[model samples]
Target: MSVQRGGLGRVTHIIGEGLEGRIANRHLALFGLGFVGLFFVLPILLLIPESLNLGSTTPFESYRRVANGIYVDAFVRSFLYGFVTTVVTLALAYMLSYFLAFSTERVRTAMILIIVPLWIAYIVRYFGILLFLSPAGPLADLTGFETDLLFTTPAVIIGLANVYLPFAVLPIYNSLNAIDEELVNASRVLGAGKWRTITKVIFPLSLPGLVAAGLIVFILAAGSFLGPAVLGGPNQTMIANVIAQAFLDNFNIQFASALAIVYTVLLVGLLLVFNTLFDLQEVLGNI
Candidate 1:
């Protein structure tokens, strides 16, 4: 029995020693980087060659087409909708999160309600919104007001904002909740009004989560294919819809790739601008 115990100890030591230096924090990055390289970077790089007509005199023709007319409008609409949706979502989420953090006696109940929608698929929720907003649907049937909201720009923005609101709420709530109550007490005791305290103290401290939420919602909303396709009109068409139509409907792979590359560049450029304005490295570090 003693010999068997000794043998087990030696085996455990050997296993521990083998794992100690072979696996590390940096090694985890290797695995992640490998996956991103194979799946993300490789695929995006391949789009460049696929987008070009290698031997043709007008190899750059697809890019030229992408720069003009409806395609340009699609790109503009995508960013515009994304920006508007982010703004609306943040305002609503911040107000809700502030209430949940400070005023609520049932934070768990409120959070569960907020999170429940996220479990429902995006398509299902958007379709439900479609039915609710349709002229013959509930708003008209119950209220006697025939609404023409479906398949419009406002409808698309509302759908995107609703779909992404839970995402914004969770982060902002965390930031607000993590704040020390004493700071708030001090602000109140120092003669600051409720509105002034929120503006001066609470809002500034919550910027980290606000920025994180904005980044997430903007990226998701901008690249959305289903929201605009399901809820928007021709005028509200976005970049993702254009890309999908080119690839799936028209089977113009080169043109689709050009659209994709341009969209990606624009999105990244916006993120760079956001980071410049917010100093994301500094802001997100707190969160």
Candidate 2:
């Protein structure tokens, strides 16, 4: 009886050790997850404390100093310009990507050649456009058209659209390429005209990619400062420019942090909406 009892005791100890090991492993994993959460949450957490107090010399004082209307207006203006840029860029990118997806080998090669300009440096692209639009530039010399577009809203829009065109195109192209050719052929065989097939079938199938491209361009355009600062005037000041002014011009660190947080939140909200509507991973992976 003693020998049997001793054997049971040993078995119980072994089981207890196994349970402890499992618990330790779970605790380690939880700790790692907590650390990761802290990594992202720390900055936002810091802002909240500052914004709430408003007395601190941090960037949060902007919430108190600036009127809600002005902040909202800045956001609205940024959204308006971003929306226009995204819409135009998406439409053009979709057309170009679709063409690349369906065109003959020679046409594909030609389209790639056209896309090569997108791979160049952004500053170079900006200057290249400037050279053509400036008073002494090619467009003025050829068409006799001239304007102070070198520092205007139109210039900012043009610069953003050009810079972000590739970001829009690459995703649409990948999504279009993944589509089964047989599906398109089947539509054509079933008495669908080219336009009808494109509108009803191709466009719907590529919606995910379109949304991805629009979101990318919108976010990029909204957060842009360099283009607007260099090419735009007071009328086209974006949210990013506002943040810069708060920090650099006014030396208002607390207000700048508040604006920065607001800007980040807006971008995050947009991204969440896009992810909810379309599979971001699928579209981004393709791009």
Candidate 3:
């Protein structure tokens, strides 16, 4: 009888401990959610009222402006730039990641030489392109080319690529590092060439990083204002640029808030698609 009572007590203690653990975990989760709600979610929610208020004087007119064609144009342009930038950045980062992962020590040294530009300040690096492509800058002086690249579509892309390349690179590099070497060796032993081995065995395994880097670059490029503002002219304006102009130039906080809300929705939708495709946590494992 005593033994049975002791067994029952042990079971009861285990159950109580589990219950306590669950309660503690739930409390921690709620606290974390509250923090996020206060900091991140609240500010976004606030945007809705500000965006919808129209104005102090003209309440009905604000909604009309937000639905105008200009915002739609900016949205489309922003998405286009983001897409192109994401593709180029992904390709370059993938190549660099592959080289860094599999190259011999001497090759790695050469690869590092290529990657060193990523350490430079973004504005400085972008403006350097201006200098290179400007008619009075080095390229015109040396090569005798008269065309200027400033304020062009390519300039915006280059600026965005320079700024966000590192974001793509690190994730891909970490994924490459996590690859099993034996698989590559086995592919080679089975009469696979270097290209074949990489395509067949390496790239398929790096899908997680590919998805991660692409999504990250997409998000950063999509939301970026500085690069477009500095490097682009009227034709290259983006959603972020319009939003900034709304706030700073026009003082249309409500319309800017609306644009911002739309931007947030776009990013959220993209992020959801990405999270569904690949686990960002798994992709960014070591980075």
Candidate 4:
């Protein structure tokens, strides 16, 4: 009888403890939600009112002006630059990642070399590209063949690709590394050549990582300021530059806020399309 009572008491104690743990977790979740609401959500909500110029008769005037003006060209240029950067970055990163994952014995050393550039300040890195591509820079001096590249669209694309290459490499390397050696062996045993095995098996499996890396690179390139600012001419200026001009140079807060709102909505819509096209949850899980 005493043993039974003791067992019952212990079970009750465990149940109480579990209840307390759940309550604590609930409180922690609520606290985190509250913090996000206060910081992120509240600021975005305020931006809406500011963009609308609320309590005045002329609401949405800023949005109409932005939609009809040269800002549309800025949006197109930004998307073009972003697409070019993503393609270039993905190509280089995939090659490097494949070598590191499958071909290299000195993976750690190579990875360190790849990651070292990230430690440098972004402005410094962009400036370095500026100098490197200059008419009098090493590339020009080495080849003795220099046309104008400084402050150009190609320069911006190259700079963005170089800056975001590391981001693409890491995800791709992780995905490639996660691939089973047994699968490669099986493909070989099944009379598949190395290239065939890679194309049929390895590449397919690595799609998730590729998607994740591509999306990340595209978004970063689209929104980047430093790349265009340091390496691009007036024609290369992106939507971010326009937003900065509206806010800082023109001091048109309503116009800037409207641009920001539109940009955010477009980004969100793009993300939704990506999620629908590719299972972003699965892609991120692979990463």
* Stronger candidate by TM-score (3 vs 4): 4
> Tens digits of per-residue lDDT for model 3 on 1-287?
34555788889988988887467666878998999999999998999888876446766456567678978888888989999999999998888888787775665665566578777877787788777778798888998887757899998998898788878887787788789999988999999999898899899888778887888899889878888887889988999889999999999898888889888887788777766766777765634
Candidate 2: Cα lDDT at 274:
69
Model 1 score (lDDT)? 0.93
Ten consecutive residues with minimal summed lDDT in candidate 2? 52-61
Q: Model 3 residue 142 lDDT? A: 92
lDDT of each: 0.93, 0.79, 0.83, 0.91
Q: Which candidate is the best by lDDT?
A: 1
Pairs of colliding residues, candidate 2: 58-254, 59-253, 59-254, 59-255, 60-254
For model 1 the local lDDT of residue 244 reads 91
TM-score of each: 0.91, 0.75, 0.78, 0.88
- Model 1, span 1-287: residue lDDT tens: 35545788889988988899779899889999999999999999999998998899999999999989888888888999999999999999999999999998999999999999999999999999999999989988999998888999999999999999998998999999999999999999999998899899999999999999999999999999899988988888999999999999999999999999988998899899888988999999999
- lDDT for residue 258 in candidate 4, whole number 0-100: 93
lDDT of 4 at 219: 96
TM-score of 3: 0.78
Q: What are the runs in model 1 whose C-alpha is more than 4 Å off?
A: 1-25
Q: Relative to the unseen true structure, what is the Cα RMSD of model 1?
A: 3.6
lDDT of 4 at 17: 81
The Cα error of candidate 2 at residue 6, in Å, is 59
The TM-score measured for candidate 1 stands at: 0.91
Off by over 4 Å in 2: 1-45, 49-60, 68-70, 106-119, 271-287
